[model samples]
Target: MQRIHWFSTLLLGFAAASSAQQAAQPAPAEAAPLSAPVGTDPVVTQPAAAVEAVTNVVDRAADAAEPAAPAEAAEAPGQAPVQAVVPGTPAAATAAVAGSTAPREGKIPALDSRLFPRYDSLQPKVAFWTKVFGQYSENQSAIHSSTYPNKVFEVLDFRADAMRLDKLALARLKNDEETRAKARYNRLLEEVDRLRDSPQQLNEEQRRVWQLYADVPGERRFRDAVGTLRAQRGLKERTALALETSGKYMPAMESIFRSYGLPVQLTRLPLVESSFNVEAYSKVGAAGLWQFMPSSAKIYMRLNEVVDDRRDPWTSTDAAARHLRDDYNALGAWPLALTAYNHGRGGIARGLQKVNGNTLPDLIARYDAKSFGFASQNFYAEFLAASDVEREWKTHFGEQLQRNAPLRYDTVETKHYVPYETLRRLCDADDEVFRKLNPAYRPEVIEGKLYVPPGHVIRIPAGHASAFNVGYAKLGSSERFDSQRSFFLLHKVAKGESLGKIAKQYGTSVASIKSASGLKNDSVRIGQLLKVPPREERRPGPVIVAVGESKPSLTRAETAAVEAERREQARPAARSKPKAPRTHKVRSGQTLSSIAKQYKVSVNSLRDANGIDGSHLAVGQKLRIPAS
Candidate 1:
């Protein structure tokens, strides 16, 4: 009976608790009303009214139960409170129902609030999706974050696991991109390295040695030089001729370089400087095989119109070698010396100072030296490349070159204008050979009686000393002639002065002045100088007239009549004279003037007769005819 009583008591309690829960929850009908269409008017809602009625009944019961439970707890004393029977009951249930049935508290919880924040702030809120995706996702969002939200699904961090996943999916593509980038970077580095290492590619000695050949304009220049060593056909004939003429001085140059312990390759420098033409003159007034400008030539070799020692290959080469040696000593390096050659020693020294004792490469990188232009900067490389090509070409084409005998010569001192042809004849040398060897001579004459200048040296062909001496004995002592006396007097017409004044100044008649200067209608330019040929000396006496005297007088009318008569006479003379013959052989030591004098003619007549194109003449040459 007691067990039944206890079971009945438990059943009663369970029934009461079930009844309370049933009351707290909305009825199915009332819950249906709460699910009315979203846009429906809330004020007219019968569903919300039913829900409120149920809620009020449940709240009233809970309030009455709360007071009664407290009163019972006070009556029972130590017993547990009735409200404590279900802790967190109403609040927990409300939260769960709100979470499930209502629009989710945070839509798309991982991405919603933080990434698309409700307000603008200095620090962005941590987006819900960004946190779910972790650090890399947050970084991605940070990268693209702005006030507007668009295409949110496309956000994937470059450093994220998603990127790694893609890489794994396309392994070949990732590898190819990486390889291409690395290769490009490495190629750039290699190019930089090549430029950096260029300064070291050649030693100072090698640089100096190669500079002699490298500074030339083209490979053909050096090839032409070497071609002279072996007789070859083509453009090398002139080069060979130069070599034959100038090579005689190479040994002397070599000796100078060796004296200074410099490389023998320096002997080739003159080949480029002046094409072995001792008389070569540059536009800038640099002369000789070394092509030294007037100022520089004076510093090294002696120069004067009478005796330009700079034209003496031996002397000039020696001087160049000495200058180079001095530069090398000061700089203590061959490369610097070579640079000094292009840009003077002082310039190189300043450049070196600017670089603070660095190597050539370092100096190039650190300093902005303008000397390294297209030609000058690559000058050394060109020399090296050219030398290599020339050496190989010579080795292969050696047989084609003509083998001219080595030049051998003796020096003679000359003070007077000995015609070059005369020297050639005396020395038993071909006129061509003599002219080639003695290029500094203008008019082919060495002026003044001096043993060549103090340093002036003349070259004679081999085995001609005794013949030259015998010829010299036959030639008479040198005579001096006044070149100024050869000039006819030119009288300057003063301002406001007439031809009469000029004639008076020149001791000639006005008619003579007008005739000589080609004055038309007796009008002349002011300050005009009329040329007056020297006349025979006259003795003071009264004029005498012979029978039939009509030689013409100095009066204007008489002068006009005489001129008219002369014009009439000249007309017949012009018609009667046959055209002068043309063509002539170039005689030894015969200039245009001398030839004209020999033929009792004018220089222009000789020029026209022979069709001579210029003042220069090659001895023994035959010329074309001119209709004089």
Candidate 2:
């Protein structure tokens, strides 16, 4: 009976095969399957050509299942897709999804998405930049503005480059009236130049307030420049936002300041420095909310390869407290102390001596030092303006502004050097949370160049101490989260190289390189091997040295050549057998009489240079004069 049943099944299979062969037909485009899985489980009745088509589809899908090409190679310009074959397995599918997210190749990689949420806390509040814009409004120096009539407004900056157009101007520039905007910009510059040359009339009150101009060389020019400046009324939208955002930090900053016996009002200093911008950096090397220069920060903060305390709001506020206290002690007045904060103690001291005055108003009016430029002169006034705005924000901005909640965090001291990643994981917080709490750590530490130094305290989310300890203990005894224990590259100095160049190359800084390599000075030599800090992503381009310090690495031979060239330049020009009459160039604010006195030559000789019969001497006009 079993043999009869098996024979009956075999005959049924043969009958089905014959039926499939008889129904064989060409495969059509519309008949293609949406997906193909390798390894047939069920047999279907189809033509031989259709079976081959199905096999080809399955082969292509299996090839696609291979891990995607590296993100950089796949995204390369004019790149073509590559088909590869791999064994049909779950692991291959898992890898294909994972490979799609490879780190992008670019000068600046996309910041971790987790960082986006924390940006508001780290970045300058919109209100802060708005306040900056308002401070410069109603002046003759505006570049352009969308909110104002004719889309133009004035800005004032001691540093020429700081007088940039605000967001409103930027938006207006992107409009169809860009040509008109440019014309208005040029007109503003011309107006400022014209005002600088034109004489200005000042009221009695204005003259008293601007008494510092009495002894200035170009009093008329300076007076006109000052007269054109107008204070803005009411708070701008961004300034209002700044006030609201600053509320979050006010509690912490005020607490820190009060702890150090500082006036709570001092907490508002960041309003002028950066509008409480944690990442604010200046061309002159000032940084953070407090705007501390490297030299000054070194006194009250830990500024080194592993950390820059200036960027940490809490740490920097403490440092600022110490500095402000020291300045008050030396100057015996808040006005002088504040001025010294901007102008340096030495500069303020020199100004006091030159003017023979102790009061800020008197010194400001009488002191005529060259270094007492516009920025130093107006630092206190700007502070006063910022303070007033903070005090009267409600009247100016109403209730439209929104404030951030106060920051809350707890601190933990590391028993040993710990990696940021390890500590972040131990605290069970995201990267942004970890970074926002500890902004003092240098990029090297964040990028994995170094570890949290031994005995250093790092901030973590509130109420995570127990979890932190548990996670830390779970790790092996030998897991000493140190950079040296991890992979790092050692670079050998070749020919001419500089700390700046090497730092840029490795996406670090001169200070970081110095701290890592234990360098004592800016100088480096050929064949000297230095440890290059590890970076998660290195910018691909030429080294970007700060402006005014673009000196490249120089070899021994090049240094010698530079020295020889300097010597040649320093050497006096070869004199003719008979010395020709020296010439004097008439400069602004200079008279013929002044030129004659300077060169110890007669005014008649200067007049005879180009037959100048009148006392007038145009600026830049070359005049022949007798040798001293």
Candidate 3:
């Protein structure tokens, strides 16, 4: 597979935990260590023939940038390493992509700067990101301050003059990068000390560090910056690729936003979200073009064992539009609203209340909540940078940018629970093609074990609509099912029930059963609980410390998880409860009214008792009952 890069970059503010490549998996040990007065290396890099630009990395778009702890998050696994791009110099003059050598002569897509005006205070951050998104390539690492992201002090080119690398080579390179970075960190502090009193005695690199923090008085902030130094892999390759990829889905997205009376340019967000990787799923359970966490996505899109609309571009786009509109309405500011898309609206609202300010700059400069870490701070800057890169990608890559044509497909509704293979063959659709267009279908549905849910919308290949309609029209009672196949959603252990026996009962492998629930061993006890396993497609790859003073969260949050529900749920019973209430997992075809009636309680009481605000329920979703 030509591992696409766009899917990774569209995940905004997430250091692309979504389907992005390893930070040009640094071939570190290949290069010689820096000599005296060393702050950065600006060697020429970014050779297309050498760079694995499209290797899939993860974009934790929905996973807000958590406060970075001392340790950094690792990349998804199974990717062959490539050199990181070095900054301060252009890449080899070969076009970034295979396109016309001549730059496209046309007016660039003009974003409404008023809506996202680059604040003077935030311009440095935006410029730094421009370099990350357009100037630097995947193989390049800009060692800069976490607090002062624009104060880039070093450019570590892990390429070590190599284009590609094996695992051994990658390990060596990573080791070399760590050694050099650690050495340089101390050397920077030492150099600043040597030049502390000798303001007049400064080398090119030393002078560069001093000038980077010219905004702050004295050299204390310089030392502080060195202490906070981190390396962020550039996304030039990824964002450029995403710009090309955006063509396939941008038209529909822009139309969707416009339908919601939003700025059409907001459609460029996927460049920041998962680099527009519609299939990008985080280590946390955030998924889809919108990168909705399962807890949050369940409210807008169908997310369950059978379907995850977050993975479906069409459905996810509509959901994102609605979500963004709602965010904007609540925050009353585009910058804060966009930031809230990643940082929870509740968190942002709390930040606003704390600062008593509502501006993006205010939040960026002042918000100090535990969760308002790197991603939250730089989210607006990233959005602006991505938007800029996407708008004028030709300026950055010239003829290398060859965009895909807009996706053309007609959608049809399934009349019944149709077998995936039956409809697939009827429409003459290739299985892979079918899968991409209907990404929301869970593996069971795609494998034909489970049928397409009734009334579900399926996108048809450009020319296969008529064939699908004909096939669907002829579906007999035996051909079209009205219900999903039985799913072993949960299993309770009986005495002497082992994982082997449980796997057999579910027709699944024991390893998978263990993987789904993170089970360590096969020991089973009476009343033990377990669920079927989820496939682990992406393992943590090479570790790269990306931007933001705060940490990038690898976990998904309930951003849409309203606090009202939590408070309501937390309200203790007026009377000291005698016993805890029993819980129930919602099953298909069941509603609150039915459940409440069965429990002999009012629907309103059920809503007040638990945090549930909507009538919707997913199978296996547990709800706590109130004690009478």
Number of the predicted model whose lDDT against the real structure is largest: 3
Candidates 1 and 2: which is better by TM-score? 2
The lDDT for every candidate, in the order shown, is: 0.38, 0.49, 0.58
Compose the digit string of candidate 1's lDDT tens values, residues 254-315.
44455556665555455334545555665445567765655555455444433455665655
Q: Write the per-residue lDDT of candidate 2 for residues 12-112, one digit (tens) a residue.
A: 22233343332222222232111112322111111121100011011122111111111121110110111111112234222322222111110111212
Model 3 TM-score (2 dp): 0.64
Task: Give per-model TM-scores.
Answer: 0.36, 0.48, 0.64
lDDT score of residue 36 within candidate 1: 13
Candidate 2 segments exceeding 4 Å error = 1-238, 481-628
lDDT of 3 at 313: 74
Per-residue lDDT value at 63 in model 2: 17
What is the model-wide C-alpha lDDT for candidate 3?
0.58
Identify the runs in model 3 with alpha carbons over 4 angstroms from their true place: 1-108, 190-195, 198-207, 491-628
After the best TM-score superposition of candidate 1, give how far the Cα of residue 48 lies from its true spot, in angstroms.
99
Please say which candidate is ahead in lDDT: 1 or 3: 3
Model 1's TM-score against the true structure: 0.36
